[model samples]
Target: MTSIGIYGSLGRMGQAIIEVAPSLGARVAGGADAQDDPAPIAAKADVLVDFSAASALDAHLAAARAAGTPIVIGTTGLSAKQHEAIDAAAQEIAVLQTGNTSVGVNLLARLVRDAAARLGGDWDVEIVEMHHHHKADAPSGTALMLGEAAASGMGTTLGEARVTDRAGLVGARAEGTIGMASLRGGSVVGDHTVIFAGQGERIELTHRADDRAIFARGAVRAALWLAGQKPGRYTMDSVLGDAVLGA
Candidate 1:
């Protein structure tokens, strides 16, 4: 059985991973919280799964790198600099970082990319997402992930095509732009919808996350897949190939 280490042992996602790991034929090698050192856990496990805060990413990556261990990152609310760090770390250790770890959400991203590519520029793209009230980020990372998918479909980057805010007198929606909106309330696990509106019709692709366990399961699956890989960056699509994704 694969031995998995966890970087955020006390959080909901971490707990979920621990609960589900055994059923997936994996055992917890060890776990570390915010105040603890992760290097020890990284040293012993076959792979590491991180669900910790973005602020601790560098340390976690460093620990994994030092131990020559593969790591799966499911943390959200990351900045450009943090992504750069992950990219840099990938040069030495296998690292898989994703905004959301739910298998359904990753599949939705694939579908959004395919639809955006085939729909043409005349179809306006918009993304809306909601999470629990305690969540800190606006325009949750998953929203941006979907926006990136839509933009990629159009052969454009999210930076160039994304429109995150709209106010009075903003005028007509810009052609080919991907709009985003974020909502927070109650105990919502997560809800994402991608809309493609054209002249005569509209298409909506949605994914609703009802439980955190789904993410935990996907993360563990990803960790197991990543354990034996060569050093490089990866995504859920990499973990779930075209056959599994039904692509």
Candidate 2:
């Protein structure tokens, strides 16, 4: 059986992963929390999954790297420096990182990319997302991920096309720019919708996550796939494959 270690073992996502492990053909070898040392878990498990705070990322990545264990990072709100660290660690061990690790979400990203590419500049692209009230980070990581997909299809990066905040006198929406809006209320698991508005018609693609199990399953799937791969940086798209939409 595939043994996995979890960072942020006390958090909601971490607990969800542990709960869904058996059904996903994996077992929880152990876990590490803010108060605990992650080294033991890193040394014991076949692979590691991090759903912890961005502040703890450095130590977790270091532990995994030292042990030569593959790790899947599901934590959001990471800085560019942290991303660079992940990239550096990928040179020594397999590393998979994502904003939202839901098969459906990953599949949705594929669809958004294709739609943006075909719709051309005439069709304005917008992404809207909402999460639970307690969730932090505006626009959500998933929203940014989808924005990246849309931007990629538009032959640009999210950094160039992303429009997050809008105030009075913001002026007309820039052509070719991808807009993002965020909502937080109640106990919403997750909801993301991408709108493609054109002159004559509009197309909207959406995905709703009712439970955390979907993300847990995807993380497990990534961990399993990472185990056999050579040391490198990987994404859910590669793990699920370009043909995953049909699956």
Candidate 3:
């Protein structure tokens, strides 16, 4: 059995991971959170999975490195510098990181980009995303990633085309602008939709995550899959392998 250690034990995702670990034929050796260090618990595990905040990634990665354990990071909203650090750490140990862990979400993301590309440049692509009220970021990382994929598929850079949130005085929608809108409400887990709007016809690709456990399960699955990969930086796509997408 693969021994798994979870970082961010007290959070919702972390608790879900800890709860899901046992049934997946894996053992939870330990976990870490704001109040504590997970190194002691991680000492007995073979891999570490971090579902913590952006601020906690450094300490979690440090503990995993000291223990020489592979880490699967499912946290998002990290800056470019932080991403570089994670990639560099992969050289010493295996690492897997993903913006969204729901298998269905990953699959939908792939299809959205492909559809955006196939639909042609004339179609205006806009991403509409919503999450729970407690979320910290304006555009959820997943939303931005989806937007990036859409822009890339159409041979454009998100930085050049992204128009997040609009106020008054904006004229007609700009051509080629990858628009993003966010909604935060009661307890909604997550929702994303990419709309390809054009003359007479429209296409929409959507994914909704109702339960947090789905992400927790996917995270555990990723940790298991990462154990077999060679030491290097990887993504959820790598862990999914032939399962790179799900319907």
Best by lDDT: 2
lDDT of 2 by residue, 156-236 (tens): 999999998897789999999999999999999999999999998999999999999889888988998888889999999
- Model 2 compared with the native: what TM-score? 0.97
Comparing 1 with 2 on lDDT, the higher-scoring candidate is 2
lDDT of 1 by residue, 1-247 (tens): 9999999989989999999999998999989998899889999999999998999999999999999999999898899999999999999999999988888899899899999999998899989899999998888988988988998999999999989879778998889898999999999999999999999999999999988999999999999999999999999889888765552
lDDT of 3 at 59: 80
lDDT of 2 at 12: 89
Candidate 3 has a TM-score of 0.93
All candidates' TM-scores?
Answer: 0.97, 0.97, 0.93
lDDT of each: 0.92, 0.93, 0.84
lDDT of 3 by residue, 139-236 (tens): 88788878888987888889999998679888999888999999998898999999999999888888889899999998889888887777898877
Query: What C-alpha lDDT does candidate 1 achieve relative to the native structure?
Result: 0.92
For model 1, name the residue pairs that clash: none
The candidate that wins on TM-score is: 2
What is candidate 1's TM-score against the reference? Answer: 0.97
